[model samples]
Target: MDQVKTSIENGVLTVTVPKVEVKKPDVKPIQITGKPTLSTNFEEVTWAKLKSAICAIFLKQPDSCDLEKLYQAVSDLCIYKMAGNLYQRIEMECEAHISTALQSLVGQSPYLVVFLSLVERCWQDLCDQILMIQGISLYLDRTYVKQTANVRSLWDMGLQLFH
Candidate 1:
């Protein structure tokens, strides 16, 4: 025979049941939005798409950028830019092209934090290239710029020369 007892307290019902332990299956966290959804083999995504996506995310959210947005941006860019050739062997070469473009942009403006953030969002290979370009830019600035010149001094010179 089964026996059961219940009591009501503070507008609630309480009941005692047999103790049982249940194990739940381990589940992987699903990242639905703002994440790169790669193909099964992981070879379908091109580096160009990834880099552009990362850059777009940086442009969109200049202050609060994350890996998920970076990944999504890359995925979306890949789909739009290399739509027809994404599945082709040529996709493998996109990395080189992307790296060169990013390096060129960073070289043009090393002081911009956006460039650095974009590099951080990219793959290690692209990041290395960007860093190398940035280093060269910094070297040039340190070597060529006169350290003794101050903003006030420059203003005074401007007044003398122009005014």
Candidate 2:
């Protein structure tokens, strides 16, 4: 209970404390708030089902069975050989059907979730093949034009505009 005080000649006043007390540290227990939320409506669809559905669509065959069985049946078709307009038509149909199916199952089952991933993969693969073919065609076109340029030049006048 010591008290100290000082006053300045002009305008200052000061006070000091005699002692201070320190308390020991204490630990408090932590509590978790709530359970995690999970969606229980949808069943997990397998990769096999997705594969079959894609195959059926590409092959231009009917899909009568469940998605899993349809995927299995269609999976064996040679999708690579089917290109150009045919490929595009199949792709569009497949995308539409899959999207519709998935939307219809909202809160019903999670089986259609795999469709999104599978379609993306298939589309990417198809695009890659199409690009490769276009690249080859471009290379062949350039080579053919180059090879013909020399022969055509030999026959025409020095100032020939068209071959």
lDDT of each prediction vs. the true structure? 0.42, 0.39
Question: For candidate 1, which ten residues in a row score worst on lDDT?
Answer: 151-160
TM-score for predicted model 2 compared with the true structure:
0.20
TM-score per candidate, in order? 0.19, 0.20
State the lDDT at 44 in candidate 2.
19
Q: 1-163 in candidate 2: lDDT tens per residue?
A: 5677566656766656567577877978878788654334211132234334445544446545464443332232212221232223333444554455445544653567676665555455444433332232233223332454433211121112111
Q: Largest TM-score belongs to which candidate?
A: 2
Residue 119 lDDT, candidate 1, scale 0-100: 58
lDDT of 2 at 42: 15
